[model samples]
Target: IGASAILAENAAILSSGGGDTIDLGFDLNLESPINPATVTDVSEDAIEGLKVVLAASEEAAAAAEASMPQELVDHLDELSVVALKNATNLITTSDDEVDIPPKPEVVPTIATITAPQQEQQSPQTLNADEVSLAPVAFDVDLSESSVKEKTLDEQTPSVRKILKFAIPAIGVWLCGPILSLIDTSAVGVLSGTVQQAALNPAVAVTDYAALLIAFLYTGTTNMVASAQQTDRGTKDMPRTAKMMIGAMRMSTYVGAGLGAFLFVFARPLLRGIIGNDAIGPAVFAAALKYVRIRALGMPAAAVLGSTQAACLGMQDIKSPLYVLGAAAIINFLGDMLFVGHSNPLIGGTAGAAWATVISQYAALAFFIRWLSDKATKTTNEDQPGVINLSDAILEMTSKSDKKDCNGKNRRQSFRNVMDTFKGKALDAKRKRSTLFQNKGVVQNIRESSFGKAIRRRKETTTKSSTDDDDSFSTRGFLKNRFTTRDLFKLPDAETREKFAPYVLPVTSTQVGRVSGYVAMAHVVASSLGTVSMAAQQVIVSIFYCLCPIADSLSLTAQSFVPAIAEKESSMEKSAAMKKMLVNFLKAGAIFGGAMMAAVCGIPMITGFFTPDQAVKELVNSVVPLLLVFFGVHGFVCGTEGMLLGQKDLGFLGKMYAAFFAAVPYIMLGVKRKALAGCKSAGLSSVWTVFIGYQLARCGLWLGRAAKLQRGTYIAAKEQESAAASATTNMSALLAP
Candidate 1:
């Protein structure tokens, strides 16, 4: 678990590389205090160069670590503790041979430390002047030659790219409510006869149930989105699809089981819940019937939702949009044909359900075809290979031997002779220490003290100093320390034959991307549910009608962020973020202002759609509030996209939950407490809370944006200054 945690952290840092270095404190027995000012050995250019390479290395290492089986990871954690102790002993001692230390028997607890206890045993601290420190940890070497540089402008995503993706996002968000509105319109136009009304009694409950089933797909979206952030593409998209399909199948069985129970006792349940209401029992029976049929579509709809999430994660929204648009049209026409311009009938409601069922199956078919093509492509890519432990040990031993040989050659060089021997003859030394004598000398040394010599070499090579040069060799060492190549190179089968047999399969995390269609549907449904599910649908449909424009702009925003993140180009990130925000806000403002104006100047603007006086009154009261929400809707959408990019779904979930819970409470309060409650207060208590909560959340999101922007600015400034300093230092070092 610790190893997994480390790998996750490393992945995040590498992906967000902006010239930061890993500050593992090894100088004090893995407890060294980080002194940023004191550590100045690396050149800014070299550090920055390493940042880019580290990004890939970190990703690879994370993949390798994630691939390890759970049991192996648990064992690895145990071995790592032993390794750390051995490493500490080697660093503290100065013998010429390697000595392995036993792992500590007792684990240290934070509460176990006291000031007096710590004071009794402390390493001498260098005050202001002393510099050198003993080696403490293994630093793998990765080749510096692997790093590459690219121009900010050339690599950054274009405005057009952002719009293309964002547009699809907007479409995904708006389509659900529009479809719902179409259903409502078609149903409302049907005959008002008593029998027809009875046939569609539980329209409200069944609609909510359908949406509840749809809500199950939100999890699919979040998972797929996270997968995409880590480079998992559409080829692996089906794994997510399959999982969702499984979940959907399970949900369908459950929904059907529940539906059956409800259908068997529909009359009694309806009476119990809505005792005095004349419409209750009939509605309950209709709801039970609707569920029995709709339950069959659940698994297919779930799979469709999963596929949509994966597509969205891949940033391909066009397919889902096309599929849903056609589905909506088909459903509308089906509704009209079954019970047009007259009383509702069982045939009409069933016809609508059947239309939806067919559409879901069609969408499922399309998703499967797309997934197959993606899988085929992924199968051909170069992927990580599995390695076992025995081979890894052999590789370590071989590398150590080569390193020892190189050290010997350097020590035997002319420069070393001049520094150590003065006028002593090299031939005399060779004669004094012959091959046979060397064997005798080597035999005298025990493994216990042998590690000291290795420690000396580590300290000499890794000690930080301001005057140090940036060498290709040093960069290579860093590369080897951090790269995926060093993750776990187990010994070959021949070597493993002598030790404990362990199995490890190389595999990355398999959390697949969410389906774009599912996510879109939820966003639309939830947004519509905000006001009153039905009214919410009507308003959202209107908003969706303007989606072509909103969607085009959103696509531009989505495409620009990934490149900006990769390049560590703050200026471009800021510019793109700002441009998207501004445009969205402007569009929202114009939209909200126009709608509000239309409501105020012409009250019938809302009344024309509904004859129910109460429904019209509710609409009149909430128009301004709804308009305001719409005006800022663009900003909300853009912010959500940003959140997606950051892989910060926890925050999104919290905010979403709060909004959902708060809105309904306010609406319910206002309806129950009419003029008397309002007369005591300046305005209706409900609307006040409603507007307040919306504005408050908007403020919170804005604050988040500001904090992120400030962080980006600071990072950019620091990197630039470091680069400048590196240039100056290098110029002086090369001066004759």
Candidate 2:
């Protein structure tokens, strides 16, 4: 929606008339042979010709009209007077200015009509005819439509789209495991002792900032998905994409500011988190030492993640998948090459942080490339004009760059005038010697085969042609090269209206929810026994890694369901929703079951890592319980993403709000009840918090789904009845 709105705004600017203005000299030199009657016919024929041509050649027609001889133009003005008189005579009106001749023509161009220029009022004010017809503004009734009409689709799901979306989502999820494996295998092999030491600190920093990144990145998904879900036609998609790029830039700035602030005040912050004990000091010192290294990645990570989210939102996950996949590989290699050993770029914990920083930048490049590919595919718009980060910063911030008045009235008018009389003069020149209009593959083939063929034939015949013809041809080539389709790459007006309300709120809300959840998670974790907090942290991280898949499903749901609903295809919407629900349920069930298996089965895998009995027991007991809750959470995670995608943030916000309120109580309950022995209580508290929160969230979402289902059913029934009526009407028409 955010992206779409921006595109819509761009389209509005285009609609406001962005192309260059062309001024045609309408010579008032009336020749003595000009008979008013004959002139009228010629002028009328020209006007009618222009109207007909305008159906296809708005620019050329406008140009032609603008350059008409004054004699003919005056004749045309008389025609307007005659038509106005005829209209007044036919229909009775109470107006006083009934039979006056209309205003004189102010032909701006004789070229094709572009989008109508903002008509200029004559400088003389309060002409009776003009005054009577002046527009008046009024307020629309604000009362809600009492008789609720079913939305176009009424909330159906599209399994095909969902599947298309899910495949990439799954692809994105695969990155996590790939990264973990790289960390476990390559990093370990490359520098075992250094890598092991790096692990705890790396985990700690990541954990601390994980929520921040998630919230930041969520902005991308909401904006991108909103852009996709709302049908803004093709032009708006890329414009919204550009706007999102701007927003991402804003987010990066903010993130960088925060990171810098954190780096500067790291000692104080660390002291607060860990206190004055020797372990606290060591942890704080280690964190402070490496924090800046890790923090450098914040802008890149946030921006890259947001870009990927946009890709997902646009229902183009392949780009992000490929980019991230490549990045993960690079990150793995970078970890091995730069973070350990005696190469001396970085060593120990600092080396690990440096590896993360390197990986982030590598990943960022991938995302930028993906965005570029999307832009190229979607529009004929130029590659981002300037790539210097500083230039982007200035462009985004500069007030002068914000408004585009030059592109609107001046340029469009200029184009219109040039295409008028001059257009016919150039018609033979403009006509392609070839038959087919160049588009994509056709254009490619034309370039490769047809161009060569045309050149060869031209060369064979050119023994009779002159250098003047070559120069004219060169001019034509230059004109065509510079003149891409005047389609203007403007977004649709309706698209902005459709998405403006839906997208930004959802994105902002998601950011709030994720950030809140992070803070809430920590708050709850902090109150639990320290061991439980540790257990909780690990479980949450694992959950986050797995959650993306389910979230992918939910995102698919959010995008697909409401879109179907918008079609007013109730039954289809219902079917789509049911399929999504079932898929998500199955996904949740699998995730839950798998988590349980992992948690319960961890002991079997732990022998390779360590032999500490306490660590083994704590991990094994927590894993199974954590997995079940994780599965439950997985279901809702996607559902939440879907809701956000749907731009249904009010419902989503309310649901998460309730869960947040309930989680701490659940934690307190486990803590107070002393459910587990002191040695293992921490792990149990973490387990209880997740299970309780997820279970509650699941119930809330289930209830919301049921209500939406009922609404969809009613809408579907109405649509079916309407469709049947339409069929009957069609039959009656046929009988007549």
Instruction: Report the number of the highest-TM-score candidate.
Output: 2
Q: Given candidate 1, what's the lDDT at residue 185?
A: 58
The TM-scores, one per candidate, come to: 0.46, 0.54
- Model 2 agreement with the true structure over 557-583: per-residue lDDT tens digits: 544444444444456566655566666
lDDT of 1 at 9: 36
Tens digits of per-residue lDDT, candidate 1, 437-460, equal 465454455233666677676765
Model 2 residue runs over 4 Å out of place are 1-164, 171-210, 213-216, 229-240, 268-280, 341-345, 373-545, 565-583, 586-601, 665-682, 712-736
- Tell me each candidate's RMSD, in Å, in order: 23.0, 19.6
